[model samples]
Target: MGLRTDPVIFSVSVALTVLFVGASIVFTAPVDALFGTMSAWIITNLGWFYILGVTTFLIFLVWICFSRYGRLRLGRDQDRPEYSRLTWFAMLFAAGIGTILMFWGVAEPISHFANPPQNNVEPQSVPAAQQAMGYTLYHFGLHTWTIFCLPALCFAYFVYRRGLPMRVSSIFHPFLGDRIHGPLGRAIDILAVLGTVFGVAVSLGLGTLQINSGLTALFGVEFSKPVQVLLIAVTTALATTSVALGLDRGIKRLSDLNIALAVGLLLFVLATGSTLYLVRGSIEMVGVYLNWLVPLAFWNDTFGDTGWQGDWTVFYWAWTITWAPFVGIFIARISRGRTIREFVLGVLGLPTAFTLVWFSVFGLSAFDIELNGPGGLVQTVVVEEDIPGALFAFLDNFPFASVVSAVSVLIVIIFFTTSADSAALVVDMLSSRTQEGTTPVRQRVFWAVTSGVVAATLITATGRSGLDALSEVVTVIGLPFFAMGFLMMVALLRSLNDDTVPEAVHHLPTLRVHLPRRRMPRIPRIPRPADGEPAPGSPRWIIPRPGGPGTERPGPERDHSE
Candidate 1:
């Protein structure tokens, strides 16, 4: 129940941090630079993988949606607790979305606006800009969410129906069945745990990195990379500690705050910046998203400007696909009692809509800076500035610099915290046979702390390269699991009408003895109205009208008393 009960991840994290700190001291500056260079290179070379993978996923989504199995639901739990609408929305919008959404909400649209996709109209053109937002909607829409819903449905059904443990590996039940308790299952759990750790912790690192860069640019502070790391570690530690307190009090509260801050960030930029540009881009993004949605989902586009594709579109897809396992598990935890149709629609569509609003609002402000605002506001600050830093600078230029900066920092802290905490909770649920909230609070603390250490080590080893390596690992591992999940859902559908329950419980009648041996055909005969009367419900039934038992017509004019 206490930290002493479980120490694997915590011990590993400490050892990795010590090793990383030690290795850095003797390493040459050039070697360290090489590590950074390598991360960028990986992002470049493997970029196409994301594009191909996500495109394939998109095509699959359309196929599934149109297929007979698309609307399938798992298990027959007709009664379950339904989350209040507000709570459901808050949990998903805040805890479910990763830090990338927060980071890219503003920056992504701007990048597209600065250099719209090749096929897209010229940058800042009212038509082009708005269409770009549609791209945002398209990517985040059904294409992204279907995968998330699949696993969620898997978890809820297996947990409630079969009484299996709820881990990421739980999705493999149809194939693995009883083998889920073997080493292979453990391996799956470990990967999920590690992936989630790096994913959530690095988000904190990103936030602090941006905070340092923004403050240095805005308030003239010494924004050393080392200092940024320490700040990330410390800030993340605080949030993690809060998460240790438990979901109801800690994660949920922070999630609420994060959503508020997120909405506030978008609204402020929209109101104080250029409202007209944001509105125009939003409309355009929706159109672009819908029109190209199907085509982009499956389009290989290998020969068509692979370079640009590698950078923007491919990178984004890989990023999401990489995140599917972690997100899938988290989505599963909250998606209990949700129908497969509801799960797919809510997970995929709502997020897409939100992504559009975020990009449109934030990206348009960047357009103003690049086009009409300060001289270097758009290019210099954005292209010139680093990832998270760019958005902060954009905020600084607005009406209240201090207020925006403060809000930005708050959003980053809780956003990362909620992600990390919720992930830990999911891992706990999946790790053991118990449902979530049943895990000892102390056990949760261990997972959360260990995950932070894993992220810290990855950061120490290859900088953010660890995040990439971790992602690649999850994507590869999750593929087969996803396929197995697909099969299980299909099989489950076939058995929907059959009841394994005891007949006594299912309303089977009890008969002590048979009536005096009157043999009849195995099948029953149909009933008919009076000879001259037409059928009550004409043509509804295929059964022929019967004058005697099992006969379609009168049997040689039976006597009246027969």
Candidate 2:
């Protein structure tokens, strides 16, 4: 079939993209200045909201795990899972983490070590290393994934179990009812489209810059806006091709390949670098992360001078919340026929465990080099301000830096491709009136190219400053959307209670009835007792009900006539 799309969603989304891009190009300086102010204001005023919102998402998901509603199936009770646990987990891990891990896994810990959150910990000391790991874990751990999990759980339950359209506003059905199809619903969806598009664009922009840096580090290619733009064009074409190929053939395959390459790269570093130190550091940091997670999550720099929390933690919350719709909807689309418990555990637990290990390996390698080996990464990153080159510089310490760097570039590019392609499909779904079938090739390519264009335009217009501004832009947009997430959690719980489960008798022992059958004395067609009266001549044999004791005693009961 041709590329079918919703006229309103497609037109509004396209017009907004054009206007933003054109204005950004024509008035670059003003746009940059405005976004900078907006970002600064958001961080200054609403940083607390972002922190508490993310923490609440984690707590809510964890509560759902132990709630009676956990056993509820996302789909009909009889429906079996569409994919096996391993495949499901792979998709979850791949889509959820994306290129952020590649970009930050090594650099984040080093950055944290260089600039410790609290002055109490000496910079670049053992204490700094522990605290750094805790910060990185805090950013990427269960809390962040909860942002993705909350909406995913909501969308999955509404679409798969309740037979609603798979859209952002659908999760608000309980709160909005038929109003989900009104102007308010459209507004919610439009925000989702903008959030996904701009969010993905920012990620693409950042990934391309990192890829460019890797290229320069490996092959001495000069980094330029034109080169980065060209990088976006080529990779976006690959993403367009993947979108054309559809999810099973394109996204799924690439995700599987990316996982393999990621694992291979991790193992290579583990084997060549200080393997023992990485392993030991991972264990110790996990302990520290757990110990500090509670206090750190609730901290808001209120009584202290921890502006760094706003910079890192609040920014992370904004980023994750902004990207939740795309990531969450994509997760919902793939995760069908799984129970609430299964979805929550897999979405919250599996990806987090993998992220911990992934960070442990790469993060500790950079830490080891900085502390024990010849130390230059902290100087390169903090002093020199060359963030993109951090990963390649860390890899240069080991043998075959060029080859591994090349592999890292490819992994990053693929991660970018998968993220862009998946995001395109999601945009199409959000804008489309129909939600059952695959998005059309033309629509997918349109969104795919539009995202690349925006990324390139933003980077070309404002450079890294513009990118930072865009980060705040999403944060500002994400606050209201984050409120909807709480509604989704409430809606999910309500729906779970109202909807019927197919396997209720199995999961819920209370639903199983075990009333004893009464044997009446072979009386054929005896007159039935009136309401509230026992069966004729069977009062002594009346069976007790399952829920509680029977109204009349089994042995005897006095009639009102007496």
Candidate 3:
């Protein structure tokens, strides 16, 4: 379980990331322009794919839940879940979308409210307000979770269920068999690493922006490149130290702290701000989201102006897809031993519910202040382009403004650390040749530092266009993995169908159960081997008896050549 580094992947990933960061810093203007143009090209041409592919993934996951294979466990039938339900849920919520929610919960609604999504809706009107909250919830809702669900489910099924290595390429085993260990598989793992590194680094950079803004708002500190770099360096060092300490002692504790602070922040806003409005608005928004979900989910903006769609909806889908590798693998790694049904429902439902509530509290609070209270805050956000300050601006209107604002800053820092450390673990797994346990401390530390340095370098080099470059990089880089997402879903279904575990049979109403005197119980028969004996490593059929004391007892094993 010591450091078993895969030299090819580990070196190549680090070298490429360092080189890109160096080039971007040395050639700032050209690199910025290059990323901007490339991003535009991808969004303009293939934005539709990002939209439809994500929608398809959501639909595919739903089908899996209701299908016969839903009862299949991610691990062996006798194996119970590793982490308890509460810890598992908490960890997933924190690592999954905590940072994004911290970054955008306040700003996005205000941005949308100031400029409504549709052409006809008057900006800042009552309808605009409703739609703004609705759209915010929509963006962070089930759609985003589905992006994590598909890959997580696939990876879990392959690794825990089939006894394969915990690698993205393992998802192809149903299709490629042992070829999963070949060049194609290694290529897939490399792509996963690419997504993980870029996505995590960009997130680290973006979170730094929010933290920088928090400092400027609270302490009157001047925002500068040096300051931003310093923040990244400090936080990255903390994150790296946590990673070196390992998952149980480090990341889990950080995640728990994040969730606790997040809850405190949410409650303060709800109590200080409009409690009744936030509550009513949340209920109504949930209804509105459900009503509009189908149309919104499938809407690609083909007929009218596609600009807004590309900027907001399409960009969001791309961001989630880009982050899916890190988030998915992180979720999968922590979610071993849970049943498929439990995993799907918990991952998709709980986080989404939390997102909706959190967004409604913060987003609606800002909207209320804009509509009725002192209105300069929304203007500050819109006219001044001070998104990083939006949360602080909102907090300014509440009681104990300074205290809450400082707490918000702390929440952001913790969220940033949790996201970075979790991503480091995922990247370490993807790059390492080790079969199990956490990646070695050395590999984890290398990735952690590399991620932070890359982020700070890119931000320093590109200036205002730093985010645009990150966006485009993720959108473009996510395409190949996006395609793999679909294939992984297919492979999951195939593997589940052929699995030795019998599909759970729903017995139709029978007369035998009604008359018990002399009735022989109807035994559910198992399918026989297709030819002779079952293949080596394949599970043997186990016939289930009706009304038996031990219904799950194993039956005779059929030889493959029988």
Which residues of candidate 1, in runs, are more than 4 Å off?
1-78, 119-134, 217-219, 381-385, 458-562
Worst 10 residues of 1 by lDDT: 1-10
Candidate 2 — worst ten consecutive residues by lDDT sum? 500-509
User: What ranking of all candidate models by TM-score puts the best one first?
Assistant: 2, 3, 1
At residue 11, give the lDDT of candidate 3: 72
* Model 2 per-residue lDDT tens digits across residues 496-554: 76664556654665556799999978857767778878777775565667767766547
TM-score of 3: 0.87
- Cα lDDT of candidate 3 equals 0.83
* Ranked candidates, highest lDDT first: 2, 3, 1
Give one digit per residue, the lDDT tens place, for model 3 in 273-328.
88998989888888878876888887777788648888888778877787887888
2 or 3, greater by lDDT = 2
Task: List, residue by residue over 228-271, the lDDT tens digit for candidate 1.
Answer: 66766676576667667776677667767777778887788888
